[model samples]
Target: MKKSLIALAVLAASGASFAQSSVQIDGIMDAGFQSIDYKGNKVNGIGNNGSATSQINFRGTEDLGGGLKANFRVETDWNTVSNKGNTGSASTPVVAGNETVAAASTFGNGEIRAGLAGGFGAIDAGVVNYNTLGTYLTGQPFGTAIGSGFRTFYVNDAQSTSQVRSDNSVKYTSPSFNGFNASLYYAAKQTKAVDTANTVTNSVTTAYGVKQTSFGGLGAYDMQGTTEVGVNYANGPLAASFSSLKQDFKDVGTGTTDQTVNTLGANYAFGDAKLFGLYQTNKTNTSSVNNKAFSISGTYTMGAVVLMAQAGELKNDVNSTKSKLVALGADYNLSKRTAVYFRAESIDDKAGTVQAALTPATIKGADTKFARTAIGIRHAF
Candidate 1:
């Protein structure tokens, strides 16, 4: 009788454990129509991610006694127009211009991670989204949407710089203390490809004599280790953030170099209006390639509508030229989970033929200037 009771007790405990675990499904659906005019040439099409990146997310968590918990997330992104899964490679920089070169479909390409959480905060390992200067993190009025102007001035992953999502990475987030918290991340080293003669080598050399190999559109495929650190503080109506990333690189033979980027941003709310400001600096060590960017944005909320405007500039010290961006837009909330928006943005760049945000195939010449107007709808669940 005692043995039978012991078996029953074990089964009861197992059922209780299972009851403590939970799983859910959630995601965003956003799509829009865009009319782009470049150097007097116009084109119209449907675009994805106008207001927010559309994605499907599956999340699960389990209580592990005490104050600990285990969790995992699987997310996948897709282009609404093509109905193809996004591989999250659109952020990788190229020598020509921002191009759509990812595979037609990929699974779990967005922020897949598994980790634990407790009083110490959380630690996760996987392909992690580590972009600290992105629109959401910086409190950009348009949230990196069509006319945010954030992308024109600052790029999270630009050839020798940082990446939006660091693969093969481990990240640790600290528990909040007095409205302040921090994150530390590290990505393992990767094998780099050496340049061979006669090969279509699309490389860039900083003034300091460092060269980066971009085997024709495969810039992020091979690289060294990467490190990123960031901190954020939120209290009442004021919020601030700062982040720094260092990426190491290697060249043919035994030469190595590194790139670093630093960003600082803050936002403040005043009644029905809010203001945001951001400053960033990037440098390729020893190359004397110093780039600086800054932007200021503001938004006013009235009833169910929010209006946004932003202006920014990118000073490319390497080429002794500057690129400018101006954006205006508004979002109208249809409900708590749905929104309709419109954006009009323009960018002017004469320094480099390749603008990271514009499609190279669509752009005409080295000196590029363009304007885009878009209307979109978003739904979240």
Candidate 2:
């Protein structure tokens, strides 16, 4: 009789523990028609991510004893227009967050993460991303990926390049205290390339970016694996973020050098409107070249409608290069998770010379320019 009672008690405890865990699946379905004019060349067609990036996500959490918890997340990039996947770029094999880099395949793999949280904060291993930092940065006052996205999408070389999703990476986020929180990420390694035997050489060109190899092959670089730090504060209507990122490539020889990027971002809310700004700089430890970029953006809300505008500039120190952009858009909310959006953006390479095929292929080459407009509907579920 005592054995039976003890068995029932154990089963009840197990049931209670299971009850504390939960799992959910959520995603965004976004599609639109876009009309783009690439330096007088025009194309109008169905598009993906009109107002946002379309992706699917699965996440779950389990409550543990003593202020500790276990959590996991997996996500993928999708294109509603072509029903394609996002096969991230050569530089970043798997992208998980707001991106400032390039894309190689039509549909790239996004982020997969698992972690633990407690009084010390949280730690996530894998592609530690929660996505669309670009979406967050661009949306600012009024949230949409298309309108104020010119600053993030159009510029090729900018100081604050978007976050490069790392393959073998881990991140730690501290608990917020006094409206301040910080995050640190250590990107361990890169996904294997098609040509795994390619030695880190000086000036070896890859599908992603040109390698600057020289000096007895003493230097190597890989933009994928790096260390990143971000600090943020929010007290009420005002918020700000500061970040530092460093990229290092493994060495085939000796004296391998790397590069660094630093950024500052801020925003303020005033009644029906909000202001946003960002500035960034990139400096190479081995080279004399440096890059800088900045943007000012805002959004206004009225009833069920939101309006947005943003402008930015990129100055490349390599060859007196300059790129400028402007973007605008509007959105009408049908509900909290459903909306219709429209946006227009333009970019100009003021240097009047296309550099090369490096940035987004849509505006490849030097002295090239383009304008884009998109209208679509978005639903989150």
Candidate 3:
């Protein structure tokens, strides 16, 4: 009889512990039709991620004692049109000169993190999104979607190396204190190389933006990883943020050069309208060139419709190069989790290299200009 009683007690304790944990599944599905005119090469297609990246997410949390919690999140990028993963490039390739210009792939694990949280803050380790891309997501009216000014410019050189998504990373986010918080992120060294026998790997280029050829017969290369810091403030109708990111690149024979970027962003809400602004500067020790970019955007909401407009400029100070953009769009909410969106955008690059958001291609030494139009539906759950 005592054994039966003890078994019953144990089962009850297990049930109670299980009740303290919960898991949820959620995702977004977005698709659209887009027509892009890349100065003479025109293309139209059914597109994915026209308004938002389609993704599925699994998130869970377990409440522990002493005001603590254990949390985890896993996200995967999905392509609604193809029923496969995101291809991370234009479905139709653009031809510029004799080269086929294809956008670099932006597909990743999204984010997979597990960590503990308490009154002090939360710490997680895994593949994570760095805070330096605040303008791409937070400070822009389009939020990295089609027609986003920053996405059109920053996708090329600003974040080509490693400021967006990082692997083998650890991050800490402080608890909000009176509308202010801070974050720190670090990623360990990521290395890739050919065998020592193949000392001359030709013009092998690394993710850290370096090319080398058997420098002193080393036949090895590595990225020194990244360190980033961010601070943000949000209260009432105002939100502002600042971030600094540094990445080191090392080649077998070329030594190392440090690349750094600093960004500042802010947004203010005025009744039914909000105004956003962002400014960023990037530089590398290997080159004497410096790049700067700034954008201003605004949004107005009325009933079930939201209208947005944005303008931005990117400049290379050393070469007197400039790229300009203007975008206008609107979204009509069909329901709480469903909406239809429309966008029209234009970009002009005379002597610069700034690709459009949907069509990531640019002509060199020639007038690279394009106009894009898109209409899509987005559903979330």
Candidate 4:
């Protein structure tokens, strides 16, 4: 009887170990309340409102013989507040007037993977978080929660398309060596054609020989490509990284060309305090203008209270316009995964042609002066 009991116990233990070695699910959910002051008018309300902006990810590994392993990850963004009218909705509408789907899968070697993840070295390709490069270098506070601070100087003239998260991409990453790693990625544009004649409102009506039938053809350009490269070195209290990106679009026969972007950033840490800075420039052969931007930020922690501050400047060479921004924030950490934060920001437009714009906020109307203050709580799980 004693031997039988021991054997049962051992089998149970073995089963538990095998179960632990199988796949696991883990992710984070971030949400907060934000306010904006566009040209002195204050608009305050619950934002991202009850939506978690959450992600569910699964990870597993199959150990092969001879120290080899097959690893995989499948991730997808979820709209936790889909039932709520104001929550889980996109901050902005897409070109197709529909919500975007965030789903990605990666299968490859251990830490060194060659699959769909985010962008290449610094960018994100498939369904991942922000591109590694932007997240590492620019460190823009509003890139995640909000869609601001993701553009060059002149391109942000209060009227430009915001940065977009990539989709349908393949990426490769090298194993980290001494806290250093590199990555690369490519995204495929699955285009389609549309016939406006059947979709038009007035189909069978014609008076002045105006052709109501129109056809638009869309197809992926094989010659077009997006490239990203980045390198980083980190040791103890000091870390730095640099990255660059270039996007080439197939000629649409309208004399419009593709775009290119360059960015550099550095950060130094001392005890509980750190200083970060970044400079980015954007150019295009289609236009005779160039945009440049620079920003510096400082963050310090004191027990449960953390203080943060940042200043930025943007300039346009063709228009000789410039804009300046300043921000200060504080956070009280309730625990490792939860915190309460307060932030205040101000923007001053020095450009005679451009208006003052706020970071992380929109300039919907046409007013110039903008300032905002907000206090919110964020929890990551």
Candidate 5:
């Protein structure tokens, strides 16, 4: 009887442990206000404009025994101001309203993961996030308020029709060793194929002009795919990262079949200050030839004040045009989770030339020159 009781106790303990390994919920909530000026017009916009953007993330994991585990996450954006109809809204809606579930596994090495995570390596991917190449080449954080002034939809014929995110994607990550690691990823196309009409001729006519006949074209749904590879390294106070991304669209009518981008960046930190720089190039099969960008930024922290400055240039070879931006900002940290920030930026596009494609948002004033000044508070929980 005692042995049987001991066996039962073990079984209960195992059950309890299994239950403990089930799932957990955690997330962060961020919200803020913002305003901008366009050609002397003060346009005000608010809510989750910066790092304090609103979001809710829920993740769960299961221990599969033998150094293997299964994990999943369902993350979405949450507007603290209004819980309106659903978890998403028209302005700052959730990235993938009903499709934010990511399931993957981790082998014994904790560093290797396979599933629906962000892109491989240093790139982050999801319904709301940009591809690794796009993220790096854009040189902007997930939701940075700055850098939007010069944003463009297509560079060198490469089009970002949809916000960076891929559905039904599989990704893999390698463990970082000595402050270095690599990643590779592939995204599947979830689109359908269609048929079109075409004209063809069998052979040249003997005496009369060659004749052509119309026939139904045999077109299939061209499977689209995206491939991304990146490497990141961080040692001591210095860090660097690079990535390459290729986006392919098949069966689309006469559009560029592929878009390729390359990005490289490095940063160095010195006690209370840090300096960083980035470079990017975009190429496509269309006439837009090549688009290039470069930027440098620095930040210094002293007591309650953190000062920042950044300068960047974007160039489009086809247009023979260039655009430049300079910005300065300051932040006063009230606490670890809260801070007040103010920033101002100046932009210039060569006269009569289209602005560089790299700028995220347009400049606020006439002659492609303007500034943004904001004083806002941010908090995270």
Candidate 6:
């Protein structure tokens, strides 16, 4: 849920006149108690976002006339109890469940971008998700839907800084036509590849009067740029999306392999239920390392109540191992802006899914299966 407060005013740019220049503040706070059981151990505690992730954000727009507009957005989530920025990731040292409320890492900016939009389409540059995977995801069971999201899923495993989002990126979105649209994104690899440029080195004088040079590019990775393209169709009760993404690196393990991924997915709606499915494949050109995943999910909405379920499988062809996930949950809305939900999910691990490396220390072990249940409240403002 969100609220927008608008203040109208006239504005002129590029010798053109327009009206309605304003800004708005919006955010959501979701928290609740969650429980988890890994193998034979069960742990419970009060955390946050049992139903959704908590976040705060601000966005505004200035009409630039001639069907053009200027816009900016900055969003960051909070740790709530600490009243500080929230850290979306859990570092190995910060996984103690019994740690004090203020022990968690500080919050961080989620996305910040500024861009222009017009009859042709829209363009934005900043920390952004440059991939069009969302178009195909539709009602993805992952994300904030309690037990519906499977962490081992491939769609959530792409971690190349620019996979789903990047620190610096430019994205272009085409205007919709007949329920058809397209998007393209490019994220520059921030690295000084060897003798890259003047912006990568510094000079200092040694005590012996000898000129010393210090290069700040060592260990810098992700040298090549990243590119993503996506197309989607949402007509009537059917919606589908397709995307191809390529991540470039200076040297891909032994001077071989190019990391590339492709995904296709669709969603169909009928009555009070919607069906969603996605398939993805990722490969390294010069290596036998590859990953593939398939997922199916569904949601049912009855007035202010909602139910969700999901199942997925991820396979690592290189190791001939796989992981399976299943989840189910339900949500009840107290009002248009607030809700409560209960969710439970489990991951049946066969071979370790690399994505599970970040699992909290409290839940890390030689467990063949992981499970959890949670109840939470979410309110948007």
Cα lDDT, all candidates: 0.69, 0.62, 0.68, 0.49, 0.51, 0.64
Q: Write the per-residue lDDT of candidate 6 for residues 1-381, one digit (tens) a residue.
A: 455655444433322333357678888887788786665567788767666657788888887678999998877657654444345444222111111112133333566789999998999987666444474356465463455443455543234222345545788989999999999988765333332222222564223111111212223332345688888888999988888887665342223335677777788999999898878887777646587878899999999989988888888888898878788888899998888888888887775552443256566656667777888887888
Query: What's the lDDT for residue 247 in model 6?
Result: 65
User: Which of the two candidates, 1 or 5, achieves a greater lDDT against the reference?
Assistant: 1
Candidates ranked by lDDT, best first?
A: 1, 3, 6, 2, 5, 4
> In terms of lDDT, which candidate is stronger, 5 or 6?
6
- In model 4, where do residues sit more than 4 Å from their true spots? 1-23, 27-33, 49-125, 128-148, 151-161, 189-224, 252-255, 349-363
Mind sharing the TM-score for model 4? 0.68
Write the number of the candidate with greater TM-score, choosing between 1 and 5: 1
State the displacement of the C-alpha of residue 15, model 5, in Å, after optimal TM-score superposition.
7.2
Best-matching candidate per lDDT: 1
32: Cα error in model 3, Å: 1.2
Residue range 205-283, candidate 1, lDDT tens digits = 3331122233232344344567889898889999988888776655422336677878888899999999999888878
Candidate 3 — which pairs collide?
A: none
- Can you give the lDDT of residue 123 in candidate 6? 95
| Positional deviation of residue 83's Cα in model 6 after best superposition, in angstroms | 5.2
lDDT for model 6 comes to 0.64
TM per candidate comes to 0.81, 0.76, 0.80, 0.68, 0.67, 0.79
Model 5 over residues 207-267: C-alpha lDDT tens digits?
2111111111211233346677777787999788877777775433334357777777777
State, as a TM-score between 0 and 1, how close model 3 is to the true structure: 0.80
lDDT for position 273 in model 5? 82
Instruction: Give the RMSD in angstroms, all C-alphas superposed, for model 2.
Output: 8.4
Measured on C-alpha atoms, candidate 3 has an lDDT of 0.68
Clashes of each: 2, 19, 0, 10, 13, 3
Candidate 5's clash total is 13
Model 2 clashing-pair count: 19
